[model samples]
Target: MTVALMWEARASDGRGEELLAWARAQEFPREPLRRETLRAPGDRVLVITWWDAPYDAELPELPEPDGELLTRAVHRWRFESVGDG
Candidate 1:
């Protein structure tokens, strides 16, 4: 089975670059099979990591950034791969 974890956050004011740098600097206990970091308008950053584990298996995830770094709590989600589509 394959599991994908999604973590999204919105940075405060004009701190998008800072938030992106912070997210990229984070070190996981173990690296994921695949990892992607993305940013969008409104100073939002998103990270998705793919793993070779079951949907319910324990996995590494990005921790919430410090309160002053974000406008609100981070959002996360987990999904089991269905198909290439």
Candidate 2:
């Protein structure tokens, strides 16, 4: 199993395109987008995503946003198979 940690604050300007591009460059067993859940907090929101592999595993870049800048801090984890677990 793989685990990922993402933490960040949005930038003053949006980063839509940049983020999209970054997502497009990722390499994984399946779709890079994976899944995401967001929570709105007035003018800002929180994003959570799951990945097939850890962050240091090496992946593609993400797209940039055209709106307010978003800051993010991310971490990833990779776990052994169920049998191993």
Candidate 3:
């Protein structure tokens, strides 16, 4: 099974592009099977990375960005494929 990690953040006032650029410039600890990035209307950025590992596997995560770049702390979630698609 594969697991997907979702990381999201909202930029501080007028810093959406800066936040996106910072995220784009980040390096993951390991290569993912698939990855995607999305942006929302409220200066929010979401990053999803799919990995070939068990749900409970220990994997490195993206380090938190500098506090000044965000309105609040980052949000993260993990999901495992159900294989019924």
Candidate 4:
């Protein structure tokens, strides 16, 4: 079975560029990892990422920022095998 791991994060205003840059620089060696940014409907900036494997497997540690403007952050994942509905 295949699974997709998703991470969602939000940062305060004026901090989107920095946060996005830092995220882009991450070195997670997992296969088929994709990152995307979106504006939160209510507040803060949102970032989402998808990885082409189960979330429980080994993954590169994300770089930690000295200071972050993230007021709210969340992580979730879904699993689906190839050719599965």
Candidate 5:
């Protein structure tokens, strides 16, 4: 099975671009099968990485950026593929 890791963060006030840039500059501990970055209306950034691992396997994740760049702490979620979708 494959697991997908999603990491999200909201930037403080007018720092959306800065937060996005910071996220773009980060490196995952292990290479993922697929990776994507997304931006939302409320200065939010989302990163999704797909890995070839069991659902309960431990995986490395992107560390939170400095507090000054964020409006709140980062959020994360993990999901495993159900079937050939």
Candidate 6:
């Protein structure tokens, strides 16, 4: 199975760039099959990592950033790949 973990955060006022830099700099103990990082309006950042493991597997995830950098707690979700079109 394939699993994808999503981590999203909203940075504090005017700190979007700093938050993006911080997220991009993070390193996992083991790399995932694929990873992507994105930024959006309203100072939001999104990171999605794909892993070649069972849906119930315990996998590495990105931790929260320093409280001072964000406006609210990070949000995360996990999904298993269903099928391709």
lDDT of 2 by residue, 46-71 (tens): 34445566546664333334444455
Question: After aligning candidate 2 to the native by TM-score, how far in Å is the CA of 11 from where it should be?
Answer: 6.9
lDDT values for all models: 0.95, 0.42, 0.89, 0.53, 0.93, 0.97
Q: Is 3 or 6 the stronger prediction by TM-score?
A: 6
**Candidate 2 vs candidate 6: which has greater lDDT?**
6
Candidate 4 lDDT tens digits, 1-85: 3444445556566676666666666655654555565555433334455555564655443434456556555444454546636
- Write out the backbone clash pairs for model 5: none
- C-alpha TM-score for every candidate: 0.96, 0.39, 0.93, 0.55, 0.94, 0.97
Mark the regions of model 1 whose C-alpha exceeds 4 Å error after superposition: none
Model 1's TM-score against the true structure: 0.96
Q: Poorest 10 consecutive residues of model 2 by lDDT?
A: 73-82
Candidate 2, which segments miss by more than 4 Å at Cα?
A: 5-33, 67-85
Residue 34, candidate 3: C-alpha displacement in angstroms: 0.8
In candidate 1, the residue pairs with backbone N, CA or C atoms under 3 Å apart (3 or more residues apart, or in different chains) clash, namely none
Clashing pairs in 6: none
Q: Candidate 4 at residue 44, lDDT?
A: 35
Question: How far is 14's C-alpha from truth in model 5 (Å)?
Answer: 0.7
lDDT of 4: 0.53
Off by over 4 Å in 3: none
Top lDDT model: 6
